[model samples]
Target: MYVIHLRYTGALAEIDDALEAHRLYLGRQFDAGAFIIAGPKVPRDGGIILAASMDRDRLDAIIAEDPFSQQRLAHYDIIEFKATRLAPDLNLPQSPWL
Candidate 1:
């Protein structure tokens, strides 16, 4: 799977405006099964992580439609990951590697 890290770097005002659209987009992804988990940073400064499709091209296309990207409210860095291990108690229907 891949993790997209989105960090806000511009004015909070712009981020606020984009937040709603961003949330909606994320909801769509969830409904479409393209998004597994997503949320903001705990400290409110680290950014957000979106764990979903591993295809960078597909992920990039989705991010291109994000409000943050469209409005230039934030910058994003994507990282590809391979699931080498998972907690023994962890339970998920799909492979953690996606």
Candidate 2:
């Protein structure tokens, strides 16, 4: 699993300009099952994305497609981790062994 943390590097106006494109890109990723959950941060400065079922290289390639990356509106910090457990009601591909 992976947690993609994005921090805004550009001004809010610049970020807004590319928001739609970024959302469209996210939509495509979700459709392809490359992303599980995504949304803006509390202060609206950046965002977070939960992704799984892929390797780091593949995830990097996908992140490269995000408009934020293409426009240099944000910086991404990718953290890879192993899933150890989940709540009983939560279901994810990584839950198979749970």
Candidate 3:
């Protein structure tokens, strides 16, 4: 599993300008099964994304295409980890986590 954290580095105006394009990119990634969940942080300074792991290089390249990234409006922190627990309601395979 992987978690992507984004911290805005540019002005709010700039971030807003790219929000739509960023959402579109997110939609595409969701459709392609690259992402599981994503949302803004509580303080709204940045955002978080939960996703399936792919080749690190590919993941980096894919993220680099985000409007925020393209405009140099944010910094991305990608963290990869092995999950060892999940709730039954999630209905996901336990093999990887276990």
Candidate 4:
């Protein structure tokens, strides 16, 4: 029900390291059923989008633990909003309504 948009602004050399951490973080979130979908932007854009829990506190905790934040590898600008609509391709097996 919430999406996190993250932007990376560090040296390009750090991308690989940053991605490793991101992968672990995403794995944890997925296993915990906190994150719905997450991935990097196309064209190698320095950004990623993560769809996550509806709870702001939970989302904030997850972001705080991000490797990008811990290693100072990237800066993040997060926006929290209700998903008023979703694409037909959107999948939510965990969602009660779904």
Candidate 5:
């Protein structure tokens, strides 16, 4: 699993300009089952993406397609974790094993 943390580095206008494109990119990833969840941060400074079922290389490549990344509007921190547990009601594309 991966937790993609994005921090805005550019102006708000720029981020707003690319928001649609970024959302579209995310939509594509969702369709492909790469992203489990995504949304803006509460402070509106950036965003978070919960991703699964992919290797680092591939995930990085896919992330590069985000408008924020391509236009240098944000920086990404991709964290990998071995998920050992999940709420019983939650289901994800990747297997969360012990």
Candidate 6:
């Protein structure tokens, strides 16, 4: 699993300008089963994305396609971790914490 944290680096106006395209990019990823959930931060300064486990290189390429990244409007902090647990409703493979 991965937590893709995006911190806005451009002005709000600039971020807004690219928001639509960014959303489209997210939608594509979601359709491809790369993203599980995504939303803006509480302060609206950035966003968070929960991504399904995948190859690091593939994830990087996906991130690079984000409009925020293409426009250099945000900085990304990609945190990868082993998911030792999952919600009952989520059909992930059983882990130690299951």
Per-residue lDDT of model 1, residues 33-96, tens digit only: 6777788887664366556545677778878888888878778888887767879998534632
Candidate 3 on 1-98: residue-level lDDT in tens? 68999999998899999999999999987777777789999998999998776777877877988999999999999999877888878854322222
TM-score of candidate 2 versus the correct structure, residues matched by position: 0.90
* Model 2 lDDT per residue over 1-96, tens place: 789999999999999999999999999988777888899999998999998757678889999999999989999999988878889999864422
List TM-scores for all candidates, in order.
0.81, 0.90, 0.90, 0.76, 0.92, 0.89
lDDT of 5 by residue, 1-98 (tens): 88999999998999999999999999998888888999999899999999885667888898889889999999998889978999999876753321
How close to the true structure is residue 98 of candidate 3, measured as C-alpha lDDT?
Answer: 24
lDDT of 6 by residue, 1-98 (tens): 88999999999999999999999999998888888889999999999998888888989999999999999999999999988877878884322212
TM-score of predicted model 1? 0.81
C-alpha lDDT of candidate 6 relative to the true structure: 0.89
Q: Between which residue pairs do clashes occur in model 1? A: none
What is residue 58's positional error in candidate 2, in angstroms?
A: 0.6
Off by over 4 Å in 1: 93-98
Give the Cα error of residue 52 in candidate 1, in Å: 2.4
Give the runs in model 6 whose Cα sits over 4 Å from its true position.
92-98
Better of 4 and 6 by lDDT: 6
Ordered list by TM-score, greatest first: 5, 2, 3, 6, 1, 4
Report the lDDT of model 4 for residue 72. 78
Number of colliding residue pairs in each model: 0, 0, 0, 0, 0, 0
- Candidates 1 and 6, the one with greater TM-score: 6
Most accurate candidate by TM-score: 5
Over 4 Å off, model 5 = 94-98
Point to the candidate with the largest lDDT: 6
Ranking by lDDT: 6, 5, 2, 3, 1, 4
Error of 4 at 83 (Å): 2.5
